[model samples]
Target: MNATATFDPFSPDAGTHQGGALDGHALVQGDYGTAVLGYDLASQVLRDKRFQNSALRLMEEFGITAGPVHDFRARSIIMLEGDPHLRLRVPLARFMSPVTVRNTRDVLRRIVESINADLDDSAPVDFYRGVAQRIPSLVYCHLAGAPASDAPQVQSLSERTLSLLTRDRSLTPVIVEAYDELFAYLAGLIARKRAEGLGDDMLSYLISLGDEGKLTEQEVLTEATSMLEASSVNTAHQVGLVVWTLLRDREAWQRIVADPELIPAAVVESLRLFPRTGVVSKIAVEDVELEGTVIPKGSDVHVAVWSANRDPGRFERPEEFDLDRERNQPLTFSTGSHNCLGQGLAKAEMEEVVRHLAEHYPDARVVEDATRIGQAGGRWLVDRLTVHMKP
Candidate 1:
């Protein structure tokens, strides 16, 4: 809108642009097409169906022009719109609903405690590997009714498949192979569920839906695959990010320790500051205009979630952690019809992890010298996070 602000959001130093306006414009154009940099504009673009997810195109860019992987991406829930999208999204939403997440709290707490039990708090530890990276897959196993023994493979597959989001063309082969293994793994799990008879888990529910004609066999597999790919990796990093953020801010950590009821808000504030998926790329299906800029059809429109979350126009002290901040809705999980269906479960999982740390390791502090947290390709990644649980 203002001189077509120019900067690459994917650059390693992209994080340098975390203010209300990028070059005094909420929407700017560059070689990467348009970037929505303000909260209001980002919200509008995310909800507008005319702007579709660019994941399918991204796959093609990586040379996955045709095949099962491409076909699946083409039909995945993120790429769908209207009635077709609802049909796929509704089934998964039922499992991640507020009631279901509330019911899963006890189980989440148990899983967190079990994972922490093996950690020796006598010395500083790599919290990222020891705790953050491990919880989500176990949670997935619980939801899908798979054996807990399958958690490691589930975590690995999710990580490799979603690595495509890193926009690394070099990971094309790894992405394809990961999806193939994912499909096979889901098929085997589905078959095993059938042999054991249907259970109450999400996968069993999908299988029953297929048997009842509510979904086709392939549709069932697609739904399961969608759940599996999205189940682990992001949440794991986010868990580490939240812990890293909370522990580093002694005031906030102390507040959370004093009142465990503040854990949820504390987690939200941390999410705002260091969202894992900082960029949500979309494509214009038809000509679209925003803030005086016309995005031609088929053009890329990257929503800079990291920038929007810290927009001084929307946040009082955009860079500071404020647990009492009202209506603190960050696009970390996104917003709109296509917003994360697993967000409730993910938040519950994070909250429980923080709660466990607060109650058991109140004196915990981040060992910053042994930690590495940075941004790349517009995503916040945790390379290492060391914490002295008893210090």
Candidate 2:
């Protein structure tokens, strides 16, 4: 738990200092044939600024854009920047606001209660799939106006999308097949909601957006499909990682279980340790310079969120999962113009599930290696996280 870890730029593993904590800046040493040779704090910040919704230009570099928009492209508000950013963000902000999350807690609490009901003291079970992994999917089911029957299918497709990021290109058709099926299924729900009108729920609220704003039938379909995909994939991945990290550190679990209020703090702490997205990319709109490296015009660069969260320069005992660490809200959710809009709902969901598990099953221990699905920039996985409850 050293506070003064020094990053060695010349080492074989420059990403980690002498210690294993990630120093993101040290990893980009011009080896990738880019304009810049190393990290440039000021320059990287400028690169995140979009001159003309140009972040999509980076995705085009990866070639996922050739697929139909039905593929759940990250090109939603996530990839938008500049003028398009303002235009797109305003409408979406209505649903994602803090107030909406506050109003949704009663439903979230019921979900936590229902998921925890599966816990049995007889023998160990995969706490993740039997419980942790399914909660977020249900959250989206309620949000998308889809039935609970859709949970397993939704979970599978979300994981498939995550894995497609890391697998051989040949496997893409398999991945797309899942994406297309999920989209088709959601499309049916969209049509039903339109005919049936808004139910007393979150998903219905989104459908009601069709009346007041510029939301087209296709845009509604597009937004709902993408939101459900993102809601399940990211939220579950994070919560699973949080549980895995806590089980890896028994002391932390013990402390939080003793005081359920600390569950929120533990979620923040776990996110700092195990980021869902390993790195975030931004394209440079113009040439920039920092740290004696000149990043020429039209270059793309990545800020390793996973790496930065662990940098010793920015945190004390950077390798330890210290819930009490008084650092800023870690970059697990990104920051600036592109921070997670669902942050409020995600936090509430995490807080509820973690609180229930800690308070009710204080001695539950992870019984298998958690499986993770990931991509080039990052990945997410959770499998075989069996847990045993104390008698």
Candidate 3:
């Protein structure tokens, strides 16, 4: 179940069944050195002050020393540590906090309803293309004060940029090429927004950082584009995953549709069962011992998020998907200071779609089985999710 052996996190027995390789270890040696698979230990690695993301080190590993892509990674709040991370994250978090998300709920609901209304249920409709991919990208564009017309461009570039992190080496050139176009597009948008004065939007918030002397022009550009890229890609794919999972079970789908109140719990359970990001990458800064395993300093640590979410120790019948589970807590978003600041927004986006599908297309079902794009550690991603909305 180590990284070297190539395990699919989406497989039925990944962490649920007894005697599985991944389930047998607190820490297992893998291609990335030591991997923490146990729920408790994985949580420790994520929250521990001794562990940090090696973005610069990763750039070296990927042989991306200097470029727009490299520059973005270096300045990214998600990649920074200590004060630097906090400095950028605090203001950005305020803009995307629960209150902000609640304010935007009406806008998000309208977007979802508008998109779902156009879906033709007569034939197999590609949910990935028609709905999942567009919603978050458009919403992000609107929130950033960018034109809604820019969504298609954002979708293309963000998806390609994310390919940089995939295990597929062939996508490196695609990623590099994407950075060129993405950087130029975002830079132009930043310039225009700057010339026009600020607005009540996320991009305006970043521009204000420059005005306040808290962030430089380049820092503002990098952070704004990075947030756009991450939020769209992460939230879009997650919506697809949740839809695919729910459609696979008629009874579960009916239960949620029958009671709209269950949409939130259903979304939560989907996240637990099929976390969008399968692994949280980290590097140990110093020697650390946890659960009887000692991880030396400078070792690459891959926290198995998918496995940890399904750990039998914390969850009863961890293999099963139950929306009504009385007590459920999953580390799908990781923990501690680095926990997803966009969770509130992500949840609202997800819940909106789920609620729409339940209320509008209660009889919808998967027209064809979803297919995985590749054999990467994350297999929950549905390359093509076609659903047929038949009454």
Candidate 4:
């Protein structure tokens, strides 16, 4: 085995290694455990079923050793593999597939316009809270057949439930309470859908499957809970990050504003640059050999997706935002069977937001002094993104 390089993937400075020699070293050792740094290696690890999502272990580490929260994480689609994973993943996948997302474009556009209509474009606005954070939950409500009035609570629940990624032990109570609320909310929503007659929505679709014996009652609830928890928080910050990245790049912004068709590539480039989920933590289920290194069973392996996205070995001029880059596939949404099921929908959401801005606020610019973006626990986040929409 080659001498393993050492670095802290969670450190604030970790992003500085992007496009550096770290990309040459496929594997690196850290206090957290092994980190797959190279683009190829990261791809391999993400696709290898020998490694499983560490979310359940993470919850246990956060002191959620048992309960509905722990039990849910243990059986969630992310933790399951093989046939079991497919059983839960396929239904959700059908809803978020490219075809479905394309059909939903009009709805997405309307939602973006509706939200932008409320923005005070005359001054620098808190774009993160005002626009980005608001869109996903609204989109969720539309998909789940819930009232738009439930958006705020849905947003709050998603954020708090996924706070486990922050690795903050202090949030144990908060995380627990959030999951409890999430379960109750999902139960009520599922019951309401049944009582009022099923409609043409994702939640209703899941219920229909349950009626046909395709999924158990518990499985139906689990699927709904999984979709709800994973839906909002990440996509919200990513929309902010993509907008913040694009608006700041004068050259790119000018091109996007001139040719609206480039909005998708522009959004993708931004996703490559500032992926919200920067690190995907997995646990080795069995001894695995990679590049001659043996990752023993039960070992933690973190894929530094931010590093892989900017790997000089994989992307030409990897640090630059090149709208013309061919095969601009990044590890932001992950890969393989366990990859993000909502990615197509997430990308569509981002593209619509960008299209709205380009069409209505071509002169928009990010207010850097009032905006705050940073990374922690290997994840990039938008704390505050202030934008002068009409400036």
What TM-score, over all chains together, does every model reach? 0.98, 0.82, 0.92, 0.98
Instruction: Name the regions of candidate 4 deviating beyond 4 angstroms.
Output: 3-5, 20-23
Candidate 3 per-residue lDDT, tens place, 1-391, comes to 2233344343445544331135355677745567666688788789898988765566656777887688788778867878988888888888888888989899999999888788777777888888998998888888899998998888888888887656566677787888888888888888898798779899898888889998888878877877866768878888988888898888999999888899889999998888888778788889987656677899878777887777787777878889888677788888888888788888889999988888878998886654443225543566878888673
Return the lDDT, model 4, position 364: 94
lDDT of each: 0.92, 0.63, 0.78, 0.91
Residue 268's lDDT in candidate 4: 85
> Which residue segments of model 2 deviate by more than 4 Å?
1-27, 30-47, 50-67, 70-75, 200-202, 368-380
Q: Which candidate leads the pack in lDDT?
A: 1
Model 4 lDDT at residue 293: 86
Per-residue lDDT of 212 in model 4: 100
Candidate 4 lDDT by residue in tens digits, 190-288: 898889999989999999999999999999999999999998999999999999999999999999999989988898889998999999999999999
The global Cα lDDT (0 to 1) of model 4 is: 0.91
Residue 314 error for model 1, in Å?
1.2
Candidate 2 residues 152-245, lDDT tens each? 8888777665444443556666666776776787777767877877786655765676666766565566666657657777787677778778
TM-score-better candidate, 2 vs 4: 4
**For residues 14-67, what per-residue lDDT tens digits would candidate 1 score against the true structure?**
887765577678887778888888998899999999999999999999999999
- Report the error of model 3 at residue 363, Å: 0.8
Q: Which 10-residue window in model 4 sums to the lowest lDDT? A: 16-25
Q: What is the lDDT of residue 254 in candidate 3?
A: 92
Candidate 3 local lDDT, residue 196: 88
